[model samples]
Target: MNLSTLTDQIEQRYHTQAEYPWAKFPDYAVFRHQNNRKWFAILMVVEASKIGLLKEEKISVMNVKAKPDEIGSLRMMKGVYPAYHMNKEHWISLNLTEIEEGLLFELLDESFSLTIKKPPQQRLHKIPL
Candidate 1:
């Protein structure tokens, strides 16, 4: 589906005020482009080749497929995504496109929910009324 269609579907289902939070994954990034004076957001997941065990099966896998520009800026480290981006000894990137939107939104919802679990440091001093 195209970006607008996907965004519309998300809004219809989730009532999202905005979606940049979905773009915050270190392995994924968001790009906004203006077309005909309108805005569009693209959620791109990066690709990486790494070895990992899935359900105890040893295999070599390619992480998510992302636009070339989006793949170049990822920070690689251990224990990030199952292991890391592309260089870690374990873990892998599951191409967001390969997964169903329902599942992806499930993950996105978890991430968004967890992100708000902590109060902002600046606002920690004030209690909610």
Candidate 2:
């Protein structure tokens, strides 16, 4: 799927907005949970060679958090690479132009869920008679 379509899916499914945090990289987009402000996914344009491609053409990619064990297997798949600027062990960069729509959404859901913080429990006080 294209960038716009993927972005629409993220906004519609997660009810969150994308933030352009870096002034220098204006095209880069970051999706984060509103409550915690932790990034779930980041979309950026980079040289294809940076992600191991032979050529230096610029390509758009989405970086998402992944479980440690799954990272190895995911790297074996086409279009998935070690995260660009995040922790390589727990995160992965997916070539937006190369992955399937279903897989992309699935990974995005995983990333979104990973960044969510649990709500605090409310405690009730007993009244003295």
Candidate 3:
């Protein structure tokens, strides 16, 4: 899916808007979780070489958090790549124009879920019973 559509869907489903925080790189948009304020996805234009593409042209890409166990297999998928600027084991970069919508949304949801704050578990205090 394209950047506009992806961002729109994210907004609609997650209730979070893309924020452009860098003055030097205004094209970079970050989607962050509201509660913990952790970033789940990033949309930006980068050199093809940055993403390990052989070509030299600029490409639109999105980086999303991935489960560590799945990162290896995810990298093997078409239009998916080792994260360009993020940790390879925990994040992945996608060729925005080339990825299928379903897979894109699937990964997006996973990322969002992964980065959310976890609630504390309740503990029962027991006396000698």
Candidate 4:
């Protein structure tokens, strides 16, 4: 699935708008939801490559802190890339190449769920600084 398609699916299912925080980096866009004073379920764009033979790679993968077994079990593929800005051993970079839109959306949902699973820490009471 293409970037637009994948992103569209995410928006539809997640009820969140895509935020392009990295404006200077046009290729990147982050999808997130805000609750109270914090933002969560942040799905950031790491890489995008084209599709087809002569096959410009149009794959986009997100960063994840995968478990040891997850990383250890991932078979290295020819054009596969590891997660960006994430611990290489504990994270994985999923290639969206040749993946169906529905499947991509499902994966994105899983990532979003995992990203937001933990609650934010409570702030300690403090006097004006």
lDDT of each: 0.36, 0.89, 0.91, 0.53
**Prediction 3 global C-alpha lDDT:** 0.91
Question: Could you tell me the lDDT of residue 46 within candidate 3?
Answer: 96
- Name model 1 segments beyond 4 Å from true: 7-28, 31-42, 48-94, 117-129
Q: How far out, in Å, is residue 60 in model 4?
A: 3.4
In model 2, what is the error at residue 22, expressed in angstroms?
0.7
For model 3, the superposed segments whose C-alpha errors exceed 4 Å read 124-129
Where in model 4 is the C-alpha error above 4 Å?
A: 36-59, 64-68, 74-80, 98-103, 117-129
Q: How does residue 98 of candidate 1 score in lDDT? A: 45
Cα-based TM-score, every candidate: 0.34, 0.88, 0.91, 0.57
- On TM-score, the candidate that comes out on top is 3
Which candidate would rank higher by TM-score, 2 or 4? 2
Give per-residue CA lDDT, model 1, range 1-129, as digits (tens).
444565566455544433354535543333222222211222433333332324433222223222333333321323123323432332224333344556445444443333333444674466789
The CA lDDT at 59 in model 3 is 90
Over 6-118, each residue of candidate 3 has an lDDT whose tens digit, in order, gives 77988889999999999999989999988899999999999989998998899999999999999999988998999988999899999986788789889999999999999
Model 2 misplacement above 4 A: 119-129
Model 2 residue 77 CA deviation in Å: 0.9
Question: For each candidate, how many residue pairs have backbone atoms clashing (under 3 Å)?
Answer: 0, 0, 0, 7
Candidate 4 at 31: error in angstroms? 1.4
Candidate 1, poorest ten consecutive residues by summed lDDT = 31-40
Clashing pairs in 4: 49-57, 49-58, 49-59, 50-57, 50-58, 52-55, 66-90
